[model samples]
Target chain A: MLLSVEDFGIEFHDHDSPERVVEGVSFTLDKGEILGIVGESGSGKSMTALAIAGLLPRKKLKKEGRILFEGEDVLTMERHKLRGLQGDEICMIFQEPMTALNPTMKIGLQVEEALRIHHTEMNDAQRKERAIKWLKNVELDDPERVYESYPHQLSGGMRQRVMIAAAMVGNPQLLIADEATTALDVTVQAQIIKLLQKINKESQVAILFISHDLSLIRQISHNVLVMQNGHLVEKGAVDDIFEHPQQEYTRKLISAIPRVEL
Target chain B: MKKWLKKHKNFNFIAGAIITGVLLLTVLIGIFATPYDTTQMNVADKFAKPSFAHWMGCDNYGRDILSRVMEGMGNTFLIAVLTVLIGTVFGVIIGALCGYFGGLLDDILMRINDVLFSFPSILLALVIISLLGTGRLNVTLALGIAFIPSFARIVRSEVKKQCSLDYVKSAALMGAGHMRIIFVHILPNIMPVLLSSVMIGFNNAVLAEAGLSYLGIGVQPPAASLGRMLSEAQSFLFTAPWYAIFPGLVIVLTVLGFALLAEGTTEEE
Candidate 1:
């Protein structure tokens, strides 16, 4: 497994009360495969991603799990080692591209920042050059203009493309895309997914794509993990789960998708 | 850029311009002019009327009011800049720590802030100046302490908000440390707000200086300050009104400059 999560659980503690937000989940992703964790809001799909990355709220959230990234227990990894791995080894793309980006920052410089931090060997001109290259790869029109423009200047789809370029530019082995395309319109969403699909195929990067849209996940993901109220109710090959859902909740969720009647 | 400026349609552009223009004029005029030395107390020219020789007239001490106002503007600006630096540096650190770490640290820092907040800012400054004694440095220190809670509160809130953002979580999952996430991702995001707050704080710093000087706890009389001028002019208002007029205008313009800059940069984040 490229990434193996064993018996992971997360509990968020409020000053007033403490409760388990996510409990007892296990999954694995092989090299270059896409794993989709699908559920409604509060189902803990995002939380699961956060736990594997070891980015849970340090003080408020209690974690118990073994997350193995290439046979290394990431849960127990030293902070310095973890820091080196983030962006360089595993990166994330947030949902709302505009809010996710530093508004005042130029798009190209923002994209290059990940490389600058993780790959300190690269100088300013080299980073800028690579950023422009990736900008074009994302099929952004006028890469130079986009590079100089701030986050607010870019359209939502364009901003998400910039984010995708930034997240992928670091050449991370694993990419966690949390609702990465949900903020865009349906057409823009399809374009972003296409871009992501292209990147995953070309780079052979493993992706954990978290989204509420089942059909969208069905299109991109190799395996689907159906989650309900923080529990992994079902998991199987994307084709298998879609064809013959073993769990009632999974079956019900799949049935809820609007169908066209002749 | 002109179209963008026009689109704002807010008091920000025009008011900001007038404010900056006035302050710039003060700085420029100060650099090149003198019917009498700002500090020179010539008993011969004492209390002279407005003329080409002394446009703003003379004070009771025979110092040229225009020269005094010019020197005062420079001193006032120096104090505001220094105090703002001290306050903002201290505030950002405290706020970042309290907001990021939370728990007992946040509680302790916030409680301290609450205590400071309760003490009317000017009164707190007065008390500190009274205790530390008076001077430019002391006034700056007092004013800085008085203004810190505002910045700290704003920074703390910004930190808390940024901390919850998905990118911050994403950065963390990737293995970025708390320091890296805080400084690199979070700090840069919150900076626009911080910049606006700093501009506002600068305005407050000038106002605080004037208040302190007027109350006799700021820059001593040999120094020219708008507030000191106002206080001195109170006694001579029946005779020479220009003593108060020029310095008052300077203070108004100074505050307006910072206020305009703050407004222009407010939406930057």
Candidate 2:
């Protein structure tokens, strides 16, 4: 297994109450596989992803369980080692591309920053050239123009593409995209999904795609994990689960997707 | 220029630029040239009226008031600049640490800041100066300490707001360290707000320095300071009213210039 999350749980502590947000979640992902996690708004899917990245709020939350990436326990890993893993071994792309990018920075510099931090062997000129190449790989029409422009200067779809380029510049083994396309319109969403599919095929990088949209998940995910209110309600091959959902919650969630008949 | 001003609605910008420019220019001019030797005393020509030779007349020590006022502007400007610089460097580091690593560290730092904040800034400066003893450098140190709480408070709140933004979280996830996230990602975003507040801090520091000097604990004797001139002229307020009036006017101009400049920058933002 490339990544194995065993008995993963998360609890948020409040002054009056301690809420268990993610409970006993277990799953495994292999190299070059796409694992889609689908759930509603408060279903703890995002928390699970954040936990994998060690991005949860430190003071307010407690995480339990082991996340072994390449047989190394992520939770117990040294911070310096974990930092090395982040953006290099297991990168992530966030939702809301409009805000995910630093508005004051040029897109090229933002992408170059990722390379500059992780790839110490690459000089400034090499980092800039590689960042531009990544931008082109994401299918940006004028990579140079997009590279020179600020985040606010580009459209939402274009900015998201720049974000993807930044995340992928390091060419990590796994990419955790947390609702990465949810904020876009249907057409742009389809384009980004297709782009992700292309990147996965070409690079053979594993992806853990999280979203609330069932159809979108079905379009790209080979294996699907269904979550409901902090628990993994169902998990299976996408075809098997979509064609015949074993759990009532899974069936209800699949049925909730609006379908059009010819 | 009038048309450009009207187009941009930059009345405050123009006014601020002009007043601050003229005042700073006076300081620069004072460095090389004054109406007469600032410290030279001529008891024969003491209390001379505001004439062409000695523009603002002579002081009690027969020193040219205009020359002394110009020299005092230099001292006042130095104190304000140093105070703001010292306060900002320490303030930004403390605020960033408190805001970024919010928990026990934040609680402790903020409480200390609160204790400092509770006192009137001038009183705090007076206390500090008393302990450090009086001089230009001591006054700068005192005012700088007094200015820290306000700068820290402003920077802390600004950093807090910036930290909650997605860009900061994204940077962290991208393996940027805490220092990198704070300095590279958060600082630039909060700089405009921080800078405007620093300008306001500059205004307050100038006033506080004057207050300390007027209390006879800042910029000791023979070193011309606007506040000291005002204090000396108190006894001759009626006879040598020009002595008090000129320095008082310069102080007002300096404070107003900084206040308006701050307002102008905020509006531009």
Candidate 3:
């Protein structure tokens, strides 16, 4: 197993009360498999993704159980060790393409930043070459032009592609895409999903895809995990979850996917 | 630049730059040469009018008014620069730390900042100056300390705004250290906001230095300051009006220059 959570839980401390967000949730992801986590806004899907990457806010936060990445306990890992693990071993892309890259920095530098941080042994010229190669890998037309461009100079789809290239450049073992394509239009969203699948196939990198759109989840993910009100309601192959959802919450989620009959 | 000037009133930009520029040039030029000795007291020329020899006339002490004003401009400009430097460097670091990593440090530092913020900056500056004793250097340090909380507060809020943005978060996930994230990743994103804040800080610094000097505890004996000249000119208001007018005009122009420059930048945004 590449990643595993053994009865993990998260609670946020309010002034008078401690609210449980994820309760005894446990799952495992194998290398090179695309796992889908489908849930509504407050279903704890995104929180799980954050916890896996150790990105959750520490203030007013409490955690229990174990989040093991490759047999090491992530919750108790040394900060420097955790730092080394992230961006190199595991990477996460966020929702808003418009704001994911720094507006002031050129896209090329932003991508090279990842390489510069992790691959300190690699000199400037090699880092630049690697960044452009990944930019091209994302199939952006004229990667050379896109490399020098600022985040605002590109469209939403192009920016998303750039962000993906930045994330993928380090050759991370796993990619946690947290609502990554949610902000794009439907057509662009489809394109992004296809691109992600292509990247997954070409690179064989494990992916933890989090989103509310069941159809999009079905398109790219091999396995599906349905969450409801901080609980894992169902887990199975993507086809099984969609064609025959066992739990009431899972069925409702499946039924909610907008479709038009001829 | 032409398009921008046409789009906005831009009167403040032009007026502020010219006034500040002239004062700056005068002070800079004074480093090389001044018409007369600022400290030389000639009893015979005490009541001299604005002549070719002394363009701004002579003070009661017979010191050349033009020379004194030039040196005073230098003092005012130095204090302004020093105050801003102290405020921004320390303030930005403290604010970035507080905002990016909130918890005990945030509570402790921000509480201290809030206490400082509660007082009027001038009053706080006076209190600091009194504690540290008087002089141009002390006044600059005092005003710099007084300005710290506001700079910290502005940076704190702006840093908080960018803290949650994905670029910052992704940078963190990419194993970028806290210092790297704060200065490199987040700082540039908030540049426009910080720039406006620094400009406003400059205006306040210039005004505070002049005001403190006017109160008589600033830029002590022999060393001239615009405010010190104004204080001296108080007695010779009618007798040698130019003595008071020249320094007073410089102070007003410096203050207005900074204020308008700050206003213009924010307006552009």
Top of the candidates by TM-score:
2
Q: How much is the lDDT of residue B149 in candidate 2?
A: 88
| A1-262 per-residue lDDT for model 2 (tens digits) | 8999999998888656889989999999999999999999999999999888878766777889999999998887889998888888888888999889998888998998777788899998899889989999999998989889999999989988988899999998899999999899989999999999999999999999999999999999999999999999999999999999999999998888897989
- Ten-residue region with minimum lDDT total, candidate 3 chain B: B260-269
lDDT tens digits by residue: candidate 2, B126-173: 889889898999989989998888888888998998888778888888
What's the CA error at residue A144 for candidate 1, in Å?
Answer: 3.4
Q: What are the runs in model 2 whose C-alpha is more than 4 Å off?
A: B1-7
Off by over 4 Å in 3: B1-9
TM-score of chain B of each: 0.91, 0.97, 0.92
Model 2 chain B poorest ten-residue lDDT run? B4-13
Displacement of the residue B192 alpha carbon in candidate 2, Å: 0.9
Q: Report the Cα lDDT for residue B45, model 2.
A: 75
B58-142: candidate 1 lDDT, tens digit per residue: 9998888888888788778888899899889999999998888899989988999999999988999998988999999899889
Categorize the docking of model 1: acceptable
B60-82: candidate 3 lDDT, tens digit per residue: 98999899889888888888889
Model 1, CA-based lDDT: 0.85
Question: Which residue pairs in model 1 clash with each other?
Answer: A86-B174
Candidate 3: lDDT of A76? Answer: 83
